[model samples]
Target chain A: MKYVDEFRDPAKAKALVKEIAALREMITPHHQTPLQLMEFCGGHTHTIFRYGIEQLLPDWIELVHGPGCPVCVLPMGRVDDCVALAERPDVLFTTFGDAMRVPGSKKSLLQAKAEGADVRMVYSPLDALQLAKKHPDRQVIFFALGFETTMPSTALTVLQAEREGIENFSLFCNHITTVPTIKAILDSPDMRIDGFLAPGHVSMVVGEQPFRFVAEHYRRPIVITGFEPLDILQSIWMLLQQMADGRCEVENQYARVVPSRGNSPGLDAIAQVFELREFFEWRGLGSIDHSGVRMRPAYAPFDAEKKFAVPKLRITDPKSCQCGEVLKGSIRPWQCKVFGNACTPESAMGALMVSSEGACAAYYNFGDLQELLQRREKEAIPA
Target chain B: MCLGIPGQVVELIDSEQMMAQVDVAGVKRPVNIACIVDEHHPPEACIGDWVLVHVGFAMSRIDAGEAARTLAILAELGDLQEEQAAMHEGAR
Candidate 1:
C-alpha cells in the first residue's frame, strides 16, 4: 500500500479535479464549444471510461480515443502469422495474456490454443525465457508486441537468449513504436487533433525526445499522462493551458515515472538486440514505413519468421467493422454499425473489443453508458 | 513492450531467491530480482525503496535524491491551492 495509497489519495483526487475544472474555464471562450482532446493511449482510454470521466467532463470538452492499443491495432496478417507459428509442430508460442482473445484473420490465439497449440500466456519476455529453458528441444517463440515501452523487454529476451546460447528460442517480432504511428495518424487527411494526451509507459522508454516531433513540427500541444484517473486529469489541465497560451511543446505530466533520459538500461538491452524493419502492417492504420523492429540478422537463429516458415498471407479486416475509422480517430465507436447489438464483447467482430483497454470494450463494460447514450440520443431528436 | 511500474520495495525478506514484495499504488505484488539482485541486500531489498519493476522483475533501484527533487518541485509549485489559485500557480 505504500506507493498506491499515496498516489490514489482522495484529497489529491479532488484537488486535481478542481485544478482541471479551472483549466477548462480558462479556455472556455477559445473554441465557442468544448475543447476536443484526444487521449492517445489505450490504457488511458480504458481508465477514463471505467471511471466515468466522460460524464464528469464539461459539455464543451470532448475526449476522443486514439490508436494506441497494440493488440487492437495488430494487423490481421500478423495474427494469422501468430496462429500459423502456434500450429507448427514442436513450437511453443508465448504472448501476453491479453492477446489470446484478439481475433486474428481466421482464429484467435485462444482458439489455436484450444486446438492443442502450445500457446502459453506470459506476463513478460523473461517468462518466455524460462519456457525456453524448460523445453530445450522444442522451438520457443514469444509474440513480441507493443510500443517503445514494451520493446525493451522483448529486446532483453532476444539479448539473453543470444548470451545464454539458447538455440531453440526465437521472437515473432510485431514490436511497434508509438511516435511513427502518431505521425501517420496526424499526417492523415482527417487531422483535427487540438491536443494530445500522450502515453506514459511508451514515453518511459523512448523518453520525451521523439514526442517533440509532434509538438514542435506538427505545432500541437501534448502532455504525456499516466493511466490513473488523477494522473490523466492533471495532464488534461496541462494540455489545455498550453492551448490557451498559444504554445506547443512536449510536456511530461507523468514525471514521477518518466524522466528526460528514460530507462537507459532498458534502452541499451533493446539497442543490442533489435533493429528497425523497413515497414510493418498495423490493423487499422495499414503499413507505416519503418514503424517497427524485427529481430536483427545476427539474431537470425532466434527469428520466428525463419524458424516456423509462417507463409505471407493477405488478410482483410471485416468490411462492416468501423475499427479502422475508430482507431484513426476519425469516428467514434458509437458510429460503428455493429457496436451494441452485433459487436458486443462476447461476439467481438474486431480486435478493439477483445482487450479491456479497447475503447469499444471499455464503453461496453462500464456502467449503463450505452443506455445513457441511447437516452441522450432520443431526447435530442424532436418528437 | 515492457511497461515498468514504479513501486516501493516493501521488504527484502525473500533474500535467498532475490525476491521481494512491491507496492504499486497499494497493490502488493511479488517481483523477482534477476536483474538487480544484490547479495548484501539478500531477500531483503529494504522497505520503502522505490524501484522500477518490469514484468515481475525489479530492474533498477530509484535514487531517493531524485524523488526528493520531484517532491521539492511539487512543493515549490504549490500543487494544492483553490482551483483558480492552482491554475494561476501552475501557469507560472
Candidate 2:
C-alpha cells in the first residue's frame, strides 16, 4: 500500500481542495458557464464517487463522468454474441468476473451459465489457456474486452498459446483504443468540456504521446490522472491552474507509473497480434472509427471470431434508457428516466448500470439514492 | 479491469518467459515481466523493483525517484497554502 496509502492522505487532499477552490475563482470569471471537466476514465469516476469527491468540490466546478468503462460501454449485440458463443455445446467460455453480469438482448453470460453453459470466471487470460490445456477436447474462448491497458495481456496470451502449440484456445477480441473515443467525444457539438482527466492505466501502456492530440487539435487541457482521490484532486488542480494561466497542454499527474514512451514489449506484442477494425460500436456512444481492434491474419488460429460461428447481431439499447445522454455528460445519471427506479444494479437495464466502474452503478452504490432522486424530482417540477 | 496495482518483484520464476513472482501487499502471484525487462535491465535486475501489475503482466516499473518528486511537490503546495493563510490572518 506504499503507493496507495500516500496518495489517499486526507490532510493532503484537504490542502489540494483549498487550492482547487481558489483556482476555481480565478477560472470562473472567464466563462459564463460552470467549468465542466470530464474525467474520461470510469476508474476515476469510481474513485470520485466512492470518495464523494463531487460533494467536496465547489458548485462552479462540475465533474462530468465520461464513457471510459469498457464493460459499461460494451454493446448489447456483443454480449449477445458472447452468449451465442457460450451456449455453443463444445465451447468453454471464460470471462472476467465483471463481464458475467452484463445483460445481453436475450440473456447475460451468467444466465447462459445458469441454463447450463460451460462459462467460467477467469482472473487472467492465462487461466483460460490453462482451461484449454486441461480440456483438450473442448474449445476455450477467452472473452477479451477492455481498452489498451488490457490489450497487451490478451495479445501476449495469444502468443503464449501459439508457443505452447495450444490450438484449442482463442480470444474473442473486443479491445478498444482510447484516443479515437476521446476524439469522438470532442467532435460532438454539445460537448461543453473545458478540460479532461485522461485515464491513467491506459496512458501507462499507451504513454503520454497519444493524448497530445486532445491538447493540440481540440485545445483542451488534459492531465493524465491516477485513480486515487488525491491523484484526481491534484490533477483537477493542475487543469484549473492551466486555465488560470490561459494555456492548453497535456500534462501528467501520474508520472510515477506512466512513462513518456509506453511499454515497448507490450506495444510490440499488441502490434504483432492485433489490427484496428474500421469501426467498433459502443453501447451508448455508437460507432467510432478505428476504436476497436481485432486479431491479425497471422493470429487467426487464436481468434475466436474467426474460429467460432457467432450470431453477429446488432441489438439496440432499450428506448427509456438515457445511457447515451448520461455517457455524453448531457445529463446526470439520476436524470435518466430509469436510473434508480428501473435500472438498479440488481437488475440493470443498461450497460452502465452493470459495472461497478460505470457512472450509473457508481452513483447508485455510493451516492445517496434518496437525495439524488429527490433532487431529480425537484428539478422536474415547474417553479 | 483497467486498475493496476503497484507490487514489488520478489523472485524470478521464469527468465525465458520473463516471468517473476510479484508480491502485492501480502499475496504472491506470478506475473510476466516482459514489458519491464530489456537488454540493459534484464529479468535478474528486476528482483527488487516495484512495478505496476495489470492482469498478470508487469506493465511498467514504478520509479521511486519520480514518486518522491511528486510527493515533494504536494508538500511544497501544502506549505504555500499555509503561508498564504498566515498572510491572510496578518491582513485581517
Candidate 3:
C-alpha cells in the first residue's frame, strides 16, 4: 500500500479539487457546454463513483464513463462460445472470476458450471497451465479476455506452456487493443467528449505513444490516470490545466508505474504470440477494425478457436437493455430504462451490470439508487 | 481484470524462469519478472525493485523517484492552497 496510500491522501485530493474548481471558471468562459471528460477505463469509472468524484466536481464538468471494462464489453456470442468450449467432454475451461457471471445467449459460465460443465475460475493464465500440467488427459483452455493490461500475462503463459511442451493447454483468445476502441469512440458522430482520462495500466504496457492520436488527431486533452481517488483528482486537474491553457496533449499522471515508452519485453511477447484480427465485436459497440487479437499461425496449436468447434454466431443484446447507449456515454446508467429494475447486478441483462469495473455495476453498487432514480424521474417530468 | 498492484520484489524464485516473489501489502506471491528484467536490470537485480504486478506478471517497475516527485508536487499544491487561503483571510 506504499504507493496506494500516498495517492489516496484526502488532504491532497481536497487541494486538487480546489484547484480544479478554480479552473472551471477559466474553462467556462471558452466553452458554454458542460465539459465532457470521459474516463475511458472502467477501472477509473469504479474509482470515480466509489469516491463520489462526480458529485465532488463542479456541475460544469461531466465525467462520462466510457466502455473500457473488458468483461463488460465482451459480446454475448463470445460467452456462448466459452460455454461451448467449457461444455466439451474432454476440455477444462478456466476463466477469471470477473467473467463468471457475464450473460451469454443461453447462460453465463457460472450457470454452465452449475449444470456440470468442467469450468473453473483461475487467478491467472499460468494457473490454467498448471491445471493442464496436473491433468495430462484433460485439455485446459484458458478463456483469455482483457485489454492490453492482461495480454502480456496471457502471451507469457502461452510462451511458458510451449517451452514446457504442454500440448494440451490453449487460450480462447479474446484479447483486445485499447487504441482502436478509443478511435471507435472518437469517430462516433455523437462524440462530445472534450477530454479523456486514459487507462493507467494499459499505458504501462503500450505506453503514451498510442494515445497521441487523441491529442493530435481528435484535439482532446488526455491524461494517463491511476485508480486511486487522489490520482484521479490530480488527473482531472491536469486535464483542466490543459484546457485552461488551450493545449491538447497526452500527459502521464501515473508515471510511477507507467513509462512513456512502455514495457518492451511485454510488447515483444505480445508481438511474438498474437496478431490483430481484422475486426472484433464488442458487446454493446459493434465490430471495430483491428480491435481484438488472436494467436498467430505459429501458435495455432495453442489457440482454442482452432482446437475446438464453437457456435461462432452473433447473438444480439436484449431489447430492453440500453447498454449500447450507456457504453457510448450518451446516457448515464440510471437513465437506462431497465437499470436497477430489470438489469440489477443480481440478474444482469447487460454485460455492463455483471462486472464491478463496469460503469453500470459501479453505479449500481456505489451510487445512491433512490436518489438517482428520483432525479431521473424529476428530469422526466414535463414543465 | 486490469487491476495492477504495486509490490516490492522480495526474492528471486527462479532466475532462468524470470520468476520473483513480490510482497504486496505483506502478502507475498510469485510473479513473472520477464517484462521488467533486462541486461541492465536482470532478474537478480530486481530483488528490491517495486513493480506493478498484474495477473502473475510484473508488467512495469514502479519508479521510486517518480513516486516521490508526484507526492512532493501534490504536497506543494496543498502548501500553495494554504498560503492563498491565509492571504485571503488577511485581506478580509
**How do the predictions measure up, each by TM-score?**
0.82, 0.91, 0.91
Whose lDDT is greatest here? 2
Judge the docking of candidate 2 as incorrect, acceptable, medium or high.
acceptable
Candidate 1 is graded, for docking, as incorrect
**What digit string (tens of lDDT, one per residue) describes model 3 on residues A155-267?**
99999999999999999999999999999999988778889999998999999999999999999999999876788889999999999999999999998778899999999
In candidate 2 chain A, where is summed lDDT lowest over 10 consecutive residues? A1-10
Per lDDT, what order, best first?
A: 2, 3, 1
DockQ of each: 0.13, 0.25, 0.28
Q: What lDDT tens digits, residue by residue, belong to model 2 across residues A92-141? A: 99988779989898899999999999998876777788789999999999
What is the alpha-carbon RMSD of candidate 2 to the true structure?
A: 9.1
What DockQ was computed for model 2?
A: 0.25
- In terms of lDDT, the poorest run of 10 residues in model 2 chain B is B83-92
**Where does candidate 3 chain A have its weakest 10-residue lDDT segment?**
A1-10
Decide which is better by lDDT, 2 or 3. Answer: 2
As for lDDT, the candidate ahead, 1 or 3, is 3
